[model samples]
Target chain A: MKPILRIGSGAGFSGDRLEPAVALAEHGALDYLVLECLAERTIALAQLRRVADPAAGFDPLLVRRLRPLLPFIKARGLRLVTNMGAANPLAAARRVVELARELGTPVRVAAVTGDEVLELLDPAQPTLETGQPLAHYPQLVSANAYLGVEALLPALASDAQVIISGRVADPSLFLAPVVHHFGWSLDDHERLGQGTVMGHLLECAGQLTGGYYADPGVKDVPGLAWLGFPWADVDAEGGMELGKIPASGGIISLATVKEQLLYEVTDPAAYVTPDVVADFCGVRLRATGPDRVRVEGGRGSPRSSTLKVSVGYRAGFVGEGEMSYGGHNCVARGRLAGEIVRERLAGEFAQLQVDLLGVSSLHGEERGAQSRPYEVRLRVAGRAEDAARAARVGEEVEALYTNGPAGGGGARKSVVEQVGIVSCLLPRDRVRTGVEMFGP
Target chain B: MKHKLFHLAHSRAGDKGDTSILSLIAYRPEDYPRLCAQVSAQAVKALLAGLVQGEVRRFELPDLEALLFVCEHALATGVTTSLRLDAHGKSLSSALLEMEIEMDRDIDTRIPTHAHAHTPTQGS
Candidate 1:
């Protein structure tokens, strides 16, 4: 009714940091602040944290940031939403409510649950990539379904002003408020499509607005003190404008927008979600100027039967070791050492996938096996059964010091086992989005 | 006629093992309850043979004054990697429009027009 205003809000530069987030919200330029704190590994970390200190888990630092900014959010009548509750939204909400009461701000907090499928994990669900039942490994660390904006609608409608969620789809935070306040239905396919595209753009905050853009020459876009969070203005006609805190740092350009559009969405036309099958290709990106890109003309259809689920598993143990090279044959020397390790692994084991990072020449390509580099670190990944051999692989890399390359003396670094076989399972049942409205 | 045809599409599109659903038709705001009822009737568990968990989402598009029920989790059937209907599959909208209401052809054509008539002449 109020010309549906939406924005993308996130922390900048800091990894899972929330101090900056609270500072941004304190500025009061956004209607809804969506924080993305979930990464493949962060979820795993949260899972581990919850095990030891249930209350200590989650990125509480962001909640601390929100504590100082709650007064401003309530004063400005802005609402906040975030997935900082990577493992526990309820516990996270309890802490927020406590903080709110402490500050004398009667802000209500709602926790959207039923996303964590870990409870229902059949240990039996089949992996989409591998036909094996997820239950094959019982020690599954973490399993969650990416909930859409629908799940946040009820809490948002309660006029809580601040909504905390766990494992929500990264883009849903940006789109949920728009859909709820504007009273948009799931079938408003086109508008939902447009809104989703906008969410995808803002989900990463500065990532698109020049935070990680491909532009090599562009520098400093001002207002760096308070980085911008993403938001949008949607109308009755299904039109949306993607903008952020006007005074925030960073630049939004066609290149940035295009790169963000392709970030996780592989297919432009068949961008699938529980709500709708969005058409990202139909989006027309125009550089209206410096930090502004106008997106329009996107389309969407009713979603097909299946929800595209993101399943993360401990596929296998992964380890990497780096060795430096020098002299005229620096490049050749690195390759020779890598070859020696590969040759040893091949002779000893089977199906060892090795990758040379930092030194790949064709690193620019999204999916490629060949690359040229001065120094190469061999990376290997396989089943836990290969852990012994993998550890041997590491030993072999260190052994290369005696058998291969010029700088083999000090170059031989011990192999560090970074990742292990993780059992990940997705339950058949998950919580669908529900709405709860409050007010006269 | 539209509902019957959509039901057929829903049956064909429903897969096994994967949680997914087929939306035979998009609904309007006024049609939300109806859509909800229809989705509720098509229990996600029933369609997946009680092996998978699923739900039906009624996507409301106030802009177009339309609603669509997305049968999510129908992919529980693990029918396919992609749930999008093949281009050759009958278009839901066209099928609804082309359906001959043997009982009221002329009246059916007037449905959309009458719905539009209820819209306010001025913006709220």
Candidate 2:
């Protein structure tokens, strides 16, 4: 891996641009291709999908596209690693296997689990803050721990071409391939730190590139469409080179890289993870080139005693409804309707307990006060039944189209009633993360 | 509220080493004078470079912004640093928040050792 071949991960696309990601994989001849699509709301969407169809798993967009690319990856013999298996890796594996067989590619597939800790949850257990066990909240829905990539090592070690995991920490998805291939030990703090950093940058894909950064210069790079995915050629020792595929859209400029660097950091000295406490204080970022940003100089120390667990429990119910109003009084009238809806709900179903997420409201703007052209969205959350009732609230506003202020036609659809689950993270010591891996 | 915290409690837990992605956001750049009176990047860098006893060898972040920094670490220190409002004084608190705080880790550093070559290579 001399001169270390590497590329930026997907440039902020949610694996939907599989064509470009695969193209990048082929062109870059990458040793590893990591696809990350999980986020906070993503978990909720996954749960909803599971509810719709237990066998259905992941977003299915990657596997669907990968079917065509499997031949290329198989011919090039590149490894694929991703956390696309939202809640069920095994099921996702089955889907991948089916897709591969259909494509007539004998690709080895592996699934990693153990992140879901819902089965270990006891209703009688109290909240870490409140002594009362979680049983009090009957709304407890989904609970999962942030599974590290330690378990995926064996699968990758087996030389599996495709490794699918459930709820893997986004950064770990990228780090696992490097660790497994390089055979890095469990305690190499510096190397793991490097892997983790790489994963973080790759996890967001293009966001670290020019997608989020508002660069003044360098326009007409190409279609933002068909963006390239990121890859890394990591050696055992922990040094890395940051690069991306050729002809990829967007520039990895200094401003772009800097914007991503400031994505989610609290302090420079105590940057912590389940694996290590990285010191960001001594780090440096310089634009190596158009799509290349160089990173060097970082410090690390031992981790704390336990890994913090991210557990999701059923919080309450929420319903979101939207209506589009065209014309001059759009923003103002929309807000007025929102206030009316809330007042009506409070007056009628105060006990129903609905919280209105003033749709697109600003930091301190008074409701219905802003005068701007806008679409209005109203969100209400409470008990399950309350959320259902809130969905009906949209109808009342629809009825107002004929009699209400600014009597003009408006359209409302996709009245959604959903429950919110809150993950009260516990220490890893308190949760279980054990899963059995089956192989040939 | 609905976030997955990659809590790097400890950095030296494996042979693979540790890393992180950090982001920094600066609330105000004009407060540099007051902020310099309070905290310095050099001080933070020194703290990171300090010879801490642990398995984590080094850490880094690739990019940084005005008041924000995103980074990955080799080892994680669970403890958090608190800037007491009273310690900085109320007059400085506003400026402190407005001050562009540097965050984000994206580099890999090695602990100084007597046996290594110019730059550490693959094998131990």
Candidate 3:
């Protein structure tokens, strides 16, 4: 087993910043960098784009996120991993090849695929929570089974400078390198679980570092504007010390670690991923130093018989509009403005949400003991089956400028068709995952 | 005197579908016992009375001095479809801070910090 594996988090989501990732590559002296960019809805949106243009559907910002860091990647041999392939892995892998050639950077790249189980998805499959069949949905847009590290190992084995994948489990992107380098048994539940927990912690990118940890005076984060991404110094035993780059501007305290450890975890005892069932309840953590935490003791059991799949279907459209009102008793005017729009769209939409932004959106029904605000924004949003019908809500809200509220300003509106989702379990035996390599 | 969870703990919220999950971590290791006693699933359910349409399930992580509260059907719909302003129910973590938990009888301050001194939590 290798002594230590240093992995840097490049980007957390599809739209995460590249600067912190570049900083990590240049100065952090990282062995591997994992950028988890895919989300549940992201794949569905990408699938829609792929339908429109066969050449598109991959992350549009993939090149921009990668081009600047090619030098660090080439010179330092920094093996980078990201699921920025979105819905199109091959195309995305090719983009990296084209970009590398353009910049005279020689790096082996690979894309892991077979996540798209759209064709195999049967409407007869029962949903996990609701138990209803997929037939209940009107339109089925895209379906992908969340893959694990088994697909990523081959690509890592190829000694690639960068690895791109579509729809692999977020944690698996980071876990693949550890498994590849250490030659750890995939069946070793405890160690896999240990590494998986680290993946989950770093998967949110800047979240562990401090981007989302801030709450102003209550939970203040300094240098937040220049927030750095988190990286880990992991051992072959799967234990690691989590820290951020110098001047990364985030606390890696017991609280921050604990918060991230439990984030999105419904059950502390059974945090399920494709590779292992991690039991985070027994996990231990302590403040190792400034911007660092020594995290260990993550336990695990055998993998689940079935994998969770995110099935996206074409849900209708959302119509939204917002207008601000200023100067004296603005709440009344904002309320009136929303009421006017509500009356116009009555019975035409499924539901209309009218919010006096400063009052309802932030304060809820309770204003506490605070005095009334000088300004409020009238916001109305609703859903419909078609674009024209959905567009009516926003159009009516805009119409209220001349038709109702006297001093309404900054009126904005939008209509968007949505990709909705249903969750189902797929049998483990059904999926076949593999990696394809490209570039010099 | 009664103390809210915020006085002894800090929380972060995340969402999947209609459910909103908040992880509440005690500021000090000594405060874990208080959290175990006071932050019951029933109490969280009651605190989110009208806001949460479904039940609240609490999962313990004593190793981390944390409790994960999963509030089901908390969002009107999922984030993608929900017309709610916050979309992901990001504000609900602060909303949970308002919940009144039983304070120790010896404690005098209205918003008492935990027994442990503050570790430098600020990042710069």
Candidate 4:
């Protein structure tokens, strides 16, 4: 049995930087490199693109992301796993095969499917969030179950060098390889839970390495510009030490780890994922050395019987416009401009939101007594059923230069179709996962 | 004396649907109890009265010296659906740190007073 296995995170989210990931593949000496690129809304957006073109649903940067790292992967015999496939793993796997051939570094690839369960969805079912019947929303676009380690095990068992998937839980992307390499039983919840702790810590790439911890005077993290991605060395028992490349920029301290440990996580005792009900309350982090921390003591219970399925629907369109005003009473001019747009779009939009940026934007209308700023940006946004009506909100804001506010400049407007996501539980037995292998 | 939580603690905000999860971690282990006592869910909900529309639940991790605040109806909505510029509510952590709390005079010396500390050298 391999005493220890090293896994490195390549990309935290879809738009994460490429250089940090490249740094990992070239120097990190990793056994497996997992790139977690899917977010809650990414797959739903990809589904919309798939409807327009069957092969266009994968991550748009898949090729660019893989082009530079394929050589390192091939040379090092390093296994790669990612959810960059988004809505189309098969096409993404095919692109990997083609890219490998073009680079003269042929590699076996596996595409894991079965996360898409739109056909099994019943519109009459109730959403977990609102308890409203699915049929209540007429514009349903996609339904994808969050698959677990079970979905990727078959691919890992195969000789494929790269595994592409859609909608696999983020932690499962890292935990699957640990379970595979350690030969741990699926029922071994303790190890699975501890393995998940490592996954969760490393999942956000730079976040673990102090990308998000810098607060100038309070919590300063150096070398953020060249912030390095993180990697963890895990033993058979799930004990691990997390670190980044020595030459890379970023700090890995107990403070950084503790912050990420609870990020996006609500309950400390029962952090639910597809594979296991991870209990991070018992987890511990120690600063072993500079840019290195040892993590242990995470516990887990049996897996949940149901899988979370993200259902996406067309909510509506958001129309927004921004115009900046400077020099003498800009906050007043900005507020006046916002009032002008609100008046013009009265009764036309379902929701109208107005803000004088730099004055009272982020926290809503709760500005305490403070000195008035010399400049402010007026922002007017509204939601409507159709694009034309939404566009009118921005048109009114843009008209401020010629129609209402004086000295208005840098006017900007955007109208985008919003995708709404709701979650519901599906019976675990309902998901039938399979893997298709391809080679160059 | 009343001191801003920013002096003794640091926080990170996360979102799930309309709920925003903020992790408040004490810089020193000795300050955990003070954080638990002062940074109650009610206090957090009241501090973010304008943003959080629903209940605020606080989960404590004594082992980690941290407090997790889950604020419902906090994002205006979720990231994709919310019209707010900072839809993810990433800045809420900083906002929460702005909250003031009564701190003991003796404990004030424990907090870092410098504006910057040199990045620790390797193997320090």
Give residue A134's error in model 4 in angstroms.
Answer: 1.0
Q: What TM-score does each of the candidates earn?
A: 0.65, 0.71, 0.95, 0.96
Misplaced by over 4 Å in model 3 are A366-371, B104-124
Task: Tell me candidate 4's fraction of native contacts, as a decimal between 0 and 1.
Answer: 0.50
Model 1: per-residue Cα lDDT over A107-134, one tens digit each? 7767777666665555566766446786
The regions of model 4 sitting more than 4 angstroms off are A368-371, B106-124
DockQ, Cα level, model 1: 0.02
**Candidate that would win on TM-score:** 4
True contacts recovered per prediction: 0.00, 0.09, 0.48, 0.50
- Listed in order, the DockQ scores are 0.02, 0.06, 0.41, 0.45
Between prediction 3 and prediction 4, the one with superior DockQ is: 4
Whole-structure CA lDDT of model 2: 0.50
- Comparing 3 and 4 on lDDT, the stronger one: 4
Ten contiguous residues with the weakest lDDT in model 3 chain A: A362-371
Model 2: residues with Cα > 4 Å off, grouped in runs:
A1-8, A11-16, A44-54, A122-133, A215-222, A232-236, A315-317, A321-336, A349-360, A366-387, A424-440, B1-65, B69-124
Clashing pairs in 3: none
